[model samples]
Target: MPPPSPPPPSLSPDLHRVLSLLPRLASPRHLLQAHAYLLPRGGHRHARVASALLLASLRLPLRDHAAALVRRVHPSVSLRAAARLRGRGGGGLAAQLHSLLVRAGHAADPHASASLVQAYCSCGSVASARRVFDETAASADVVSWNVMIDGYVKSGDLARAREMFDVMPGRNVVSWTMVIGAYAQMKQPEEAIEVFRRMQVEGIEPDGVALLSVLSACGDLGVVDLGEWVHRFVLRRGLCQEIPLMNAIIDMYVKCGSVKKALEVFEGMEQKSIVTWTTMIAGFALHGLGSEAVELFRRMEKENVSPNDITFLAVLSVCSHVGLTDLGRWYFKTMVSQYKIKPRVEHYGCMIDLLGRAGCLMEARGLVQDMPFKANAAIWGALLAAARTHGDTELGEQALLHLIELEPHNSGNYILLSNIYAEQERWDAVRELRISMRDRGLRNVPGASSIDVDGMVHEFTSRDGSHPSLHKIREVLCAINSNIKSVGHIALLPESLHDVEEG
Candidate 1:
């Protein structure tokens, strides 16, 4: 027989178009077929084709395939390809791409280098990001500088962030925003406000992002007048139409303890996101308007806004505080079955607290036992408290044992167990527990108290007299005690009380 004719070496136009469109295709199966057709034919050498294939692979639910495809692409093309995936909320893949790029030597491109810095920062590797910044060539641009500054800011290295800010040859809104945001995240509201003032003095116009950061700081510090000032600033700057800025304004008002202003901002917004709804719901719940919070949740659903985990947490907190057990149960069930959200540990903790607080100890225990995951300390603590409150000595002991096993080094567990025994008048058990604690070198943690006055928080431990107003505080306490004694309230010893009365 004659030799078989060789197949065509080039892809047909239709096939080439299909291959080019593979990246845009959402279906993994179709993309996989395209990859199979192209990879063996040396298509991996074509930068555009390889990048498209890498992107498609990255989008797949499988990580191994994504890594293999990335490995096949050239380093520079790979870095460029990875930059396109930013802000898509893909976890860890961006960092993996950057690592591969760095290993393959694409760290020369200033833009790519900056992206690597950002990827490392986003992945919680601030040290690695700093190393990359230090080693990269001096051809760094504005984006590179911003990335490094933001990385330091995001990683809570405010001092280094400030150093970078001071040395930056060119200042932009982003730079100012990063510094202000760093101060805000550090809870240094006064410093954040000072940064905003400095930005203004430097003739830098505040953008929506900068305004949001400053507003957040003002809210955190309870600077209601400053919050209102920023609100007017937004309106004057014609930024009220911006959805994110408006949402931030609402959040600021709520956090500043001005619910009326928060509602006004909410009503004035032309558009609202899920965050807006969640923030308002949380604010309502915090202000003790549980029914209003639920009603707002219902309104959010009516507006076709999807409830995220934060929304559920807000509504659950409202249910917990308001003693709406049935509503809470319904919402919890709806969240899992209808919304398809697997309850996280925080959600489970809230539910346990709710049930326990309502004297449904058995139900709470059953819920804990039936949890999909192992119970955490908060869950166990709630259970133990419920047991003590309901006088279930057996359950209390069991919970205490589990807590001790989970956290052997925690002195609080021993103290809690000892208190439980003492509450039940089991003196011998308490004595034995105390002796065991002594053997283990555990001691009770000192009691502490905090008071906020004029936006300044002062903390004191037992018998602390370090405050400048210590004498005034002592005098007030003495006056209160004298008045209480005058009303015939007498202190009684536990033994005397027990002898005089019985439960």
Candidate 2:
């Protein structure tokens, strides 16, 4: 090849300008010319420019160029590029690139070491990543610890991840945020909230991500006070401008059973995404605010915001809640006819529930028969619930058959059908159902209820008498029951003495 020409005089050697040029470099000669200028200016030490060059050179299918580029850049940049490029060649190529850094004595550099650990972790070689971490633990920084914790999380090893987190030399917002998220994903929301409390005690200011994780934990635990505190912090920090964080706040309030507070936040948001609209609609559905939900949905359309599948599901739920059968049917049809969106099983469930609850059992059963996908347990469960409510023993039996086949292990399905038979005074049929349950070794799962008291949640299960205040609670409940009974009130017992005696 002839001598490479110098970079064009018009091209500035500034980092940003060089980065802009990498994408536009069409030929090997242009790349060489740019590299010639950048190399003299120590631009290769900058991770952004080096990463761009590494990516550009690889796209050009110039192995020599990529290798030479990797060697010229800082070690941290090389390992980071290697980590990103792992998708192209997997662990084998990562090992090759890591060898190059080791040969250049760059493996001992703290940032570079962290990058190497991350590269191995990204490629799913957690063992190799751990080895590198152990070797450099003395010099490792917070970034190194964060990467290792993240790798363990990605690998689905939360126990070890938490262990590492606890033993970490120090913690930052990322560290606290990650552990909080990990616990949430593990369904340990209480632990997640506890960690958030510790984080607050440590005086580390939570960023948007940290706040999001904590909000999710609060929502899961129904800790509205902490959720409100997080909301205040967001406002105090001026991070409410982020639409996602605002969305999390709405979800937290909804889950905490504060629909009014949730709506207040919803109305206050200046900018909204489809998620915001859907969350608000679902919140209204949950709280049985059908009129408000419908109005908001119509306003959403007026603003030209397209509704997705989840949006229709929320609208259908609102209709179901308030018994707007006709309106529910219209939306269900419009979801497919106007928007060209396919109906998911959940949408069909909502529609079936609406029709069944409205005493349109025949129409609901027809929809189930005509739906495109196979009916799941939830679809049958809704039908069964409606049958029970409407005293349709025949429809209840049909729904029960499907429910049993779909969910043989679920005791709730069996109990629902039995209750329907008991309502109709079909003692023989109820006895047979009880016999079937006994033969299958399925016992009715106890029902449970919960109440929140001063930021603490208390849960009770049927037949459970374990609370410290159980005696006083029962006394109060007895007095209330006696007072109501005196006013000509009667309790409709779902499980009669005969049904209970059978088992």
Candidate 3:
């Protein structure tokens, strides 16, 4: 049987009556009223009365009343009572209360000390938090260890968090989740998956939060097979009701280049939040399915799911990819007037790009000029690229000059400018630009392309011979070259990306 509840705290008769009246007192207002009546009546010195005040005062955010209330309690009572201050956490109050505990000589009350650790962690003072942790390390409870580890993770010092995690004598689900999440936050998805595998090895069953982080890692790596396994695990264990988990599932499929699978998951969901619709719409936008993404947005509106700023961004991006200039223009207008959404720089960039691609370069230039805020590099860069594409050297030169001032060190801007001049047979200008490039110590960074085939990603760089199959690759290339030559195809080799020195 459970031990009998501790008999009612001992108290004098008048104080007992005051305590009885306090149960009718609930909030900070009632607390203050009760304290005034009792403290002036000599009940301030009574331990039981102070205990009553402490319980009620816990609701108040200010420390003056609560601190005064706890003062009259016994030290042991104060240790336990001050811990309630944790509800008012994430400020100096907890620290002040911690100081009070230290001043009261109950700094070693393990339970109270553990709660204090939480206060310091919440307030972003991990060092003070760790000091309390070290003092209680001899018999540190699991809660304290978890708090310290989480504190380190929150501070973005994952190395120290991992070190703390490794030294824990035992582990709980929270401990494992913190470590996995730290790796994910740092974008070290590989290490995240490794620790998750280790968490499984240690017999800690995973929770939904743990699974979400792992799925996120899989998405970043484009590991569809791993993501599918997680999906299976979630269904088998019945975690599907959670909308965030389902949202992550949809995101993973999209990132893995399987938009059809993402749709299936979307159609199967029983409950969809704004995130669900936005995520699905974004998946379509990324895959260049512009019409489908727009249709989904319409459906979302019909279903009464309000779109936020992110939703507009996704829709605008879709319009850019599919050359739906009219649709993009309409959406841009609707976003401001109908939705009351302020157009961000990204939205303006998308509009300018759409207009530029549709042979409305002047309109694109006008939009950039009319934008409320100063156009950024992306806006000008969009205009510059369109100018180059259309052979408008005059406009291209103007944009390029602006770009160089903004991104003085970007080699692409210089290279593109040189290319524009060379295409116009402006040989002298091209040579001068090349000289300037060399003087500035700028070179185009090598570009590498990768393709994912049969669950493996292979990256290739121009003139790179580091692949394990390099020899075989060259043999195949030689065979293709011979076939092309037999068919009378000709190839041209340029001397340099800019000016060529005659050999």
Candidate 4:
């Protein structure tokens, strides 16, 4: 057969340069102008320009224009465009592009097939990704298998992800990391640690990513000893060059309730990211070291590490807990006005709780009323607690109404209302509220206390006598009450108690 004629060159040098600039262009207006310049020439095969136009359209906020431009591109150019669409949250458009690739007869190409799978995964079309995996005639490569496994993991199908991992003919560090990371993300620390152990038993050395996953799992499970072992392993492997691993170690220690060890990890790091700073701040905050957290925040700013919402959350929570009302208010305003981060619901809730706990009942109530979004149960709960503390029965009742509307089935709201009435000596109101709670089938949550003894959690509910040490616990409680009464601590009995006794 005669050699196939060389395909016509689609793009000129000048036009290709202009097209290359399209992706870097700042505004949609500039892209549209570029589009206008290229739209009229039919014979001029500017394939590169066409691809750029497709991408620019997709990047624009207006979806319709991007879709139209995508349709106008030739199938080959569109396939390249589809590869670029991966990991951008473009759901429907990614599917359309995959269909276009199959129609163009490029689905058989391994690279093209893998790209399609990745795009499908990126768009959260797990079924479509699986279909592409099944239909491709080319032998599945490691990349294709990884894509499928990663898709399952990303979609939270850990069982399917594990199944895929087990069935794969070949496995690499990436594959092991995916499965291990899945377990860690799902809070199955034991499973994650077991997978790590298996990986080592198979003679596959753990990399920074794999080690970090195991450490995170250990932290979540409060397996401090295991976390310490992982820290030692990282050191022995000499993988300290990876900054993220250092950050992960710091995070694990902090989360495992070891602030001192977390600080040691932070100080030992040769370099740090914003995440490292945030982790340290969180540790201090969790330990109620508000001044230390604030100082760390200042140091982070001086080091030019910009604080994100999580950082703000840690600092603000510290302020709330320590009653640094003015500092909390300042940081909240600074985050919005200077950092340009819009306050989310959690931020608003923190502010409300801060004000409420500080006895600024009126201000907290007003803040909830003026919130940009509707107040949720947390906001109303803060307001109700504040009102009760300040002896504002009317305001407490109003807050309860809003709380009921928000969560009608929550018995705690009714309990709070009853408690407020009881505090005000409104026996009739309290009785009515209790009756209402009974009618609604709402029962108060039983009071429970938990203590950690030798790494094991022991819980005791109100009036619980099931523990083996029940007699000893009762004796201790009686002795404590006797000591308090001997110290002239008189328990106040309600006047209603006498009336009820007579009745």
Residues 1-503, model 3: lDDT tens digits: 11222344356687788787764565667677777877566675565566556555544544666665455455545544444443324346656667666655667778778877876776677887898899889989888899889878988889899998998988999899989988987998877888988998899998988889998987877778778989999899898899999999999999988899999999999999999999999999999999899999999999998898889889988988888989999999999999899999999998988887787898998998899978888888888778877877877888878887888778787777778888899999889988887887887876765544554556666656677876666666566666767788863323121111121
lDDT of each: 0.76, 0.83, 0.78, 0.78
Range of the 10 consecutive residues with the lowest summed lDDT in candidate 1: 494-503
lDDT of 1 by residue, 148-205 (tens): 8887887778999898889887888888988998898788977898889899889998
lDDT of 2 by residue, 233-318 (tens): 88888887899999999999999999989989999999999999999998888889999999999999999999999999999999
Local distance difference test, candidate 3: 0.78
Predictions: Cα RMSD each: 9.5, 6.6, 7.8, 7.8
TM-score result, candidate 4: 0.69
* Ordered list by lDDT, greatest first: 2, 4, 3, 1
Question: How many angstroms is residue 193 displaced in model 1 relative to the true structure, after the best TM-score fit?
Answer: 5.6
Model 1, runs deviating above 4 Å: 1-132, 135-139, 152-159, 182-203, 214-226, 298-309, 334-342, 405-416, 427-463, 471-503
lDDT (C-alpha) at residue 383 in model 2: 93
| Cα lDDT tens digits for candidate 4, 298-335 | 99998888999989989889998899999999999999
lDDT of 2 at 185: 80
Give the winner by TM-score: 3 or 4. 3
Give the lDDT of residue 255 in candidate 4.
77
